[model samples]
Target: MNLKVAMTRSSSPANGLLFALTSAGLYGFNIVYARIASFTGASGSAIVVYRVLLMLVLVGLVAAILRSSLAMEREERGKLLLVGVSSALQGIGYLSSVAFIPVTVAAVVFYTYPIIIVLVSPFVEKTPLTQALVAIVAVATLGVCLVVGPAFSDLDWRGLALAFGASIATAVQFFAAARCTRTGVVAKVFWIQLIILPTAILVSLATGQLAPPSILALAPFAVTMTIAGYVGGFVLQFLALGRISAVAAGILYCAEPVVAAVSSALILNETLAPLQIAGGALVLAAIVANVLLEQRRRLKDAALVPIAD
Candidate 1:
């Protein structure tokens, strides 16, 4: 029985990594889906409004069906609400960036969130910074620069700014979520969608960007985004965070841009410059190195813990 229990414990983190990778793939598809919706005349804010509304209804209904309590302590509610606001900002900023820049560039910029998290870890996560981690982050940053640097001169400044904003907002959202008290994944996501829905609605209305698409255009994409992106991607992401360290999850999420770039090339007829290709390779290498180093560190730490007989 003890051996069985130990095996279960050892398997969970691996499962969490699998969940994170699955979420990253779905998120990559979400980028493609968003671009398709944009081609079909859906504005960024309009897409956010639609997607958040759909997620709210779906998650809420599932929670109700499960008889899950949506209640949280007042302090936890406030933190989760802040996380929701950040998520909304990330959605708007990232989608708007894609509106003005190539998907690859926008994705690379948005991926800076992992670096941001690492940089701020000492303050927010209270984790010690090691030279090795810093070096890995630097390589990732260099990789991103290589990928997007050439296009930087041609892209709109507004798009760059929005992408950067999205990166910061995403970093904050993840950190905040990590700090929050334990809550059901569905309930947490439901509350986040609840906060995002009204904000998205107001933004779409205020900006006069709320033009509804044809049912033919809206139906397929809406269902796809709601199921694959929100339910499959983000719900799994939250679940993974419960099992793995936030830093591990963030590093794994670096897979997203690579997936997006490949998907864009295949689906959207996008091509990367040779330099960009090299940069992407570097980014993938850095993410792999980070993951391996983190695993090693975890093993070392575990070895140091005294086993009780």
Candidate 2:
């Protein structure tokens, strides 16, 4: 059985699904926008800094709206600090990839996280990897190969490494988010962003590549990408996750690459080859299949529960 199947067996499937899909959409568009911003000659470090700054303020407003305490338990704070480090690494990896590769290429590489999640699910989610699940994984992986094959020749090994690094960091993000929920939702989001801003700033300063965006250039992207689209989606996700399971939430995030691919093609004028599109479709289908299988398993388990005497 799939991990996603086990996750939905819990009490909050609807909310979990909603949270996951919303995060995927926000993250998809965030990648496209950030990639476009990177193409404008801003250093990757600089783009990350600016983006984190925006995220900081946005997260702050979210905390205020909820009237939640930003304080963290000492142990939780320690874990959150670690999550911050991973988040910072992910930001740098993603920004670096966008600097050297097409957004679609970067997105494809990062999309490998689903595979990673599946691989790790046995340990964390405690689900057996059935033959059917393995078959699905194989098909999905073949799709990834086909999608990425056209760009293989042009692979910047550095960019590819960064993309993989980002994937690892993203996997960590889901793990940490799930772990941190024992605390409070607002606090988790708060500390993650809180640690992110400082970490990004320090990294940018170390690289000596940080730059202030010109007022004119910052305004449009700020409103369209950062505020209305990216942040809005993220805030919704954070809120929804508080009411749902993180693993189930992570599965729903499967929609991201498709949205990112389409947006990159339309907005950045990046061309999508037929093979790549097919691969992306395969990945999407695999994710959907995984989710459905999990749901079925959960339904079966729930049906087995005995009524009170």
Q: Pick the candidate with the highest TM-score.
A: 1
Q: Each model's TM-score, in the order given?
A: 0.86, 0.79
Could you give candidate 1's per-residue lDDT for residues 180-201 as a string of tens digits?
A: 6477787788888888888788
Q: List candidate 1 segments past 4 Å from native.
A: 1-11, 73-75, 97-108, 147-150, 154-158, 213-227
Model 2, position 228, has a per-residue lDDT of 50
44-141 in candidate 2: lDDT tens per residue? Answer: 56765666577777667877887877788766676677677787788779767866777557766876776676677678768676766766666666
The whole-model C-alpha lDDT of candidate 2 against the native structure comes to 0.68
In model 2, which regions exceed 4 Å deviation? 1-11, 39-44, 73-75, 97-106, 144-150, 154-157, 213-219, 236-251, 304-309
